[model samples]
Target: MMGNRALLMNFMEKFLETVRFGNNDFAVIAGYGDVVI
Candidate 1:
């Protein structure tokens, strides 16, 4: 469980980085955020 949580955290970090730096579509990112949540 801990390992999975840590991996999730790492993935979230990178996902946020992509949201911050990536010039992708707002709808797509928002969709991903909704899915993640």
Candidate 2:
């Protein structure tokens, strides 16, 4: 059970990182919206 919990935590951390990266990419695009349009 402990090992499974550790694995789940590791997966959660990676998922969070991916989510953060996606948010940063979205913010960058929104910031440049005026020029993009």
Candidate 3:
């Protein structure tokens, strides 16, 4: 469970980075992701 949680956090960081520095479309997805989280 701890491993899974760590992996998820890592993925979230990378995805959030993409939203911040990559593209606008991903920001929309990341916004929804934030709501879910």
Candidate 4:
């Protein structure tokens, strides 16, 4: 049951919460790809 968009939104919400809690940092590295700064 859940739609793909709903699932994605849920995931994003969790990810943002994690970042907001200061568990990790968000960054984009060149060639190496995304890095959790």
Candidate 5:
């Protein structure tokens, strides 16, 4: 579980970096049903 979270963080960082947003304001939300992370 820890490893998976770490991997997700790494991927998100790379993605956000590529976007190059100055403010870097974003949200990852669960939509519909019962979402679990």
Candidate 6:
């Protein structure tokens, strides 16, 4: 399992990429699912 900060950091990185690519659906689905982009 990951720590809180690590999880938050990971989410932040992915969030940025999501914004860059405009993949809002991916961002929402990725919250608890392990779907690779």
- Segments in model 6 whose C-alpha atoms lie over 4 Å from true places: 34-37
Residue-level lDDT tens digits of model 1 in 2-32: 9768867766776676678774576467547
Q: Rate the local accuracy (lDDT) of all candidates.
A: 0.66, 0.58, 0.71, 0.49, 0.48, 0.70
Model 2 lDDT per residue over 1-37, tens place: 9976776666556556656777766555544552334
Clashes counted in candidate 4 amount to: 0
Q: Is 1 or 4 the stronger prediction by lDDT?
A: 1
- Count steric clashes of candidate 3: 0
Estimate the TM-score of every prediction.
0.56, 0.57, 0.57, 0.54, 0.53, 0.59
Residue 29 of candidate 1: its Cα lDDT? 71
The digit string of per-residue lDDT tens for model 5 on 1-37 reads 9987776776666556645754333322211111233
> What is candidate 3's lDDT per residue for 1-37, written digit by digit as tens?
9976776776677677877786868766765576466
Q: Single out the weakest 10-residue window by summed lDDT for candidate 6.
A: 28-37
Where is model 4 more than 4 Å wrong at Cα?
25-37
* Residue 8 C-alpha lDDT in model 2: 62
Candidate numbers, best lDDT first, in rank order: 3, 6, 1, 2, 4, 5
TM-score ranking, best first: 6, 2, 3, 1, 4, 5
Model 1 lDDT on a 0 to 1 scale: 0.66
lDDT score at residue 36, model 6, on the 0-100 scale: 40
Listed per candidate, the RMSD to the true structure in angstroms reads 4.6, 12.9, 4.2, 7.3, 6.0, 4.3
Residue 20 local lDDT, model 5: 70
Worst 10 residues of 4 by lDDT: 27-36
Candidate 5 runs further than 4 Å off: 21-37
Better of 4 and 6 by TM-score: 6
Candidate scoring better on TM-score of 4 and 5: 4
